[model samples]
Target: MALQGPEELGEPVEESEDLDDQDASSISPAEEITLPPGPGGDEETEEALLLPWDRFSAWLHCICVVGFDLELGQAVEVRQKYPPGTKTSICYLSFPDSNSGCLGDTQFCFRFRQGSNRKTSLGCFLETTDRDAPPCLKQGHYYGYVYFRQVRDKSLKRGYFQKSLVLISQLPYVTFFHSLLKIMAPEYFEKQEPCLEAACNDIDRWPTPHPGRILTLPIMGVVLKVRIPTSYDKPGTSQLVQSAQRLTPLIVVSSPPPPPPPPRCFYPVFFHLQMLWELVLLGEALVVMAPSPAESSDTVLALVSCIAPLRYCSDFRPYFTIHDSEFKEYTTRTQAPPSVILGVTNPFFAKTLQHWPHIIRIGDMKQAGEMAKQMKVKKLKNLKTLDSKPGVYTAYKPYLNKDEEIIKQLQKGVQQKRPSAAQNAILRRYFLELTQSFIIPLERYVASLMPLQKSISPWKSPPQLRPFIQQDFMKTLEKAGPQLTSRLKGDWIGLYRHFLKSPNFDGWFRNRRKEMTQKLEALHLEALCEEDLQKRIQKHTEVETVDLVLKLKDKLTQAEREKLPVHPGTLEKLRAHIEGVILTLPEDLQGILHKPTTL
Candidate 1:
């Protein structure tokens, strides 16, 4: 069973055992008291006696505590003391070692006071096997402890009690001592600064102190002492003590290293070259215009020579020439005003005379002549001739007479050939009528049938009528009457005689002329009707061709719509087809098809 401490009881024992006791003791009358020897023989001396709070104080001070096993001969014997006439009850209190074992080396025994008289009460006893058993005692050790007590104030009518204790342990006396000093005596610790450096030096000089000689220091205004195992610097002392003294405390607070310098910004080399060129150009310009003649000449020559080398530099040449030309033109034109040059024999100084009239004395001829010579030698001319011959026109006369003769022959051949459609139609309609009906006279046809020629005599006519008579006619007429001959020779008589002789001819001519006029009118009507019918057929054919084209256009539009890929289900396939179509299309057409489509 575990042993209980005095704090659990309502009274204190009158008698208690010391380190010489080995058995239980009788109780006494006092409320708080120490103990004397019991029935057991005094096997352990006071030198080996461990204080009640030794292990506890050692742990509180962060000192290492040694552990032991109860089964391995590690145990503490305890005996309780209680008062007379008290129905005493024993309770065991056990404290576990730093090891995981169950209260192996630590134990306490308590005897509780009973009966109505509360003054005669309880007692406690504590002991360690380390004193009696060689295996239980740890070597090179320090210990600390805490004890709890319930004290009654008899002066008060009512009694109250609470727990209190003192703790003590061994620690390295160093700069860190202020922390432990504060815990021990906060008021005193606050009043005085701890001599940490001196104490640390002392600990370095003397690492181990004498054991069992408890060193007392105030703990919260109460005096307390703690025991520590002593270590020697001699040959047999453990190295663990030296290792602990040499241990260096680590500090973790540190500052971050400085950041790396900002990177440099580097512009490209071409930028430098460009700036250099510009500066050189500006310097050259300033040098050329410097006031001194020797200086200006030297500057101009240097600049020109410098630029001359760069003439083969493709890009530099054009730019330099442009700048040079512009500068020269500006300087020259500014120096010579146009108004001063109209009738001036020497235009070079005209501008200088007009603008800086006071400075332009006639004595500046040498400068003007030098300038003029420079201009003549260096100026670009406007009349730049081409390296090619002039163009010439060669004469070409056509023979008009031969052309006219050829045209006339062509016209004659056309007229002699078959007539054209219009000419044929006109001749068929009016040729016979015009030649016969219109040309023949109406009176001649009517008079030709009369017998005037027989009625007139051939010999009784005037002398002019004799020329009309042939020799055969006169011989035939020799036996005839003179009236017959005169009738034949007379003008009116000849017409009547001819009409009587050719009566059948007059009738046939008149009938043929009338028939020709009637046939011509009929042919004109037929030709006009045929032409009208041909025009109507041509118009109908044109209408048919127009209708066919319109139908073809409609069909083509329908086919295009059917082939369009607007349907929802075939979108993917349509896209592929469109890509193929684009590949097959001409570049111009493909540009149209590949254009972005809006939703």
Candidate 2:
């Protein structure tokens, strides 16, 4: 609700004034009219009016223009939404750094993923703000894809129109969002608010983005085909829909197009892939310096995606500027860099972030074909960005030896004039295999923590899981690590020890523990269902029977709340059995039990 400019110049003025004229009535200059929720009478009509953010698949939330107004300086010029009362304020997202010095540049673009420093649930986050205003989705973060454009006009006081088209969304589908912005930004500069509304309507038609299913998304007369990844997917396996397959033609196409191939973002840093892989897996701080924002974001995203199947638990900003709030904290020499990956286009960062351990400086990847034709596999030099060539620059050595076979394969592909997509597939498989090999020992160790199924009992609480001992796991790893299976080997034990201290490892372990605990609960419920309830009740003393009934009721309620899977009619049968046992007791005792329990 903090609309950052004067009422006359506020982003909502144009849309509101236009509506007021059409209706022949007065309306507030700053507030948009909220469309009422549709009734359930007509499903197709309701679906047509549904806002993109209101949909279950809510890939987009809001669209706005952030620019330099002659009078207001950096301000949100105009904002447009379908239903218009989304409640969430994107004013803070209009500009990332209050003092981004590079704003004067004629043409540039960058992206930012914004969220709270620490994770919190919906209730906790809502408590700190106006309770009525909630985000469109159940998520803690949102992404902003910005396209900045400036041109000389020589007719106005500043003699130029400078603005950025900002697309805000809850989804982290980086490649898709950026590609959509590419199609909309230039056209919006020529036309205006109508274009934004058209784009939003197109987005509303997209189906729910369930993981692993192919999605056909149409926007601005182009249709994109993609598949969002699930936890089980390997790196580069999920296509982010970087390219549009076709225009929406009158003739129907028979077969759906294939999903867009994963981007070859790693081609620029091909020689130092293994070293970068080690840095990413250990969650080290890295800075990616590129010729422009597009390259910077792509490279940073690719680096983060290196260890897929294992989520990158640490913070990462695909496009970070010197104007960012954390600029001072990240650049100060007194402390080491935090575990993060930042993409930057400014030359100023080369000096400010000089103390950082790892840096990858890359040129324009648009000339990837030319680079492939000219270059070959070569040794890398120490990372020096200020006056050095584009290459990976890091002093820290890697634990595993570089796999010469993979290198040879990639180099051969490059020499053969093979497409970037083929090179990407080959590299993706290598990393996927590497991650699996590294994780096998950890998987084998955690599987040993489960209590034996036969040890479960209907008359007692479920057995606790065995605790994970690092020393015991290391001893196991010594005998059965990647050394037995991997062609490239160095200090597998050392690598595991290093990774154990990272955020990714902690997150993975917690998830595994939660899953195992749930399985144990389900097994306990199964055991109770299979027991002869009447015989078991008769065997126990009166006091013991009462205690068992109360505990069973509590456990059943919890299992239902958690939606744990159990045998059919398991809960209903137990409840009926409890009722029969209580009725068979003395009349006075039955009354006493009935006062506190329900069957």
Best by lDDT: 2
Question: Tens digit of lDDT per residue, candidate 1, span 1-599?
Answer: 00111211111122233312322233221243333433222424422332332222222221111112234221122212222221111111112111122211111111111223221111212221122211112212111221222235465333422221112122222112323333432232233213322221222232112233334433332332333332211211222222122232221110110111100110011112112122222221111111111122222222222211111011111001111222244235355421110111122322322322111011112221122221111111221122111111012111111222322332343345423443323322222232132123322343333333333332132111111222333243334323332211223223223322332234334444433333333232222222323233344454453343333233223223222212333334324433543444457756755554321
What is the Cα-based lDDT of residue 533 in candidate 2? 74
Clashing pairs in 2: 383-393
lDDT of 2 by residue, 1-599 (tens): 00010111112234334322322112212222233321112334434443323442245545667776667566656664311221123332333332233344322233333433221121221222211121112234455667777667678789776677776655555555556777888788888777876775676567644455567777787776756444434344434444444453211111111112323444556767888888989999998877666556667667766676566677776677765666788899998899989888777887777788888777645554544432333223444445555666667778888787876787677668688778767766787778778888898999999999999997678888999889999999878887766788798888999999998799779878877887888898878877777787787888877777677777766665454656778767767766877766778877886664332
Cα-based TM-score, every candidate: 0.12, 0.71
TM-score of decoy 2: 0.71
lDDT for model 2, on a 0 to 1 scale?
A: 0.60
Q: Which parts of model 2 are misplaced by more than 4 Å?
A: 1-53, 56-58, 70-74, 80-139, 147-162, 179-187, 198-268, 364-386, 538-550, 553-557, 560-599
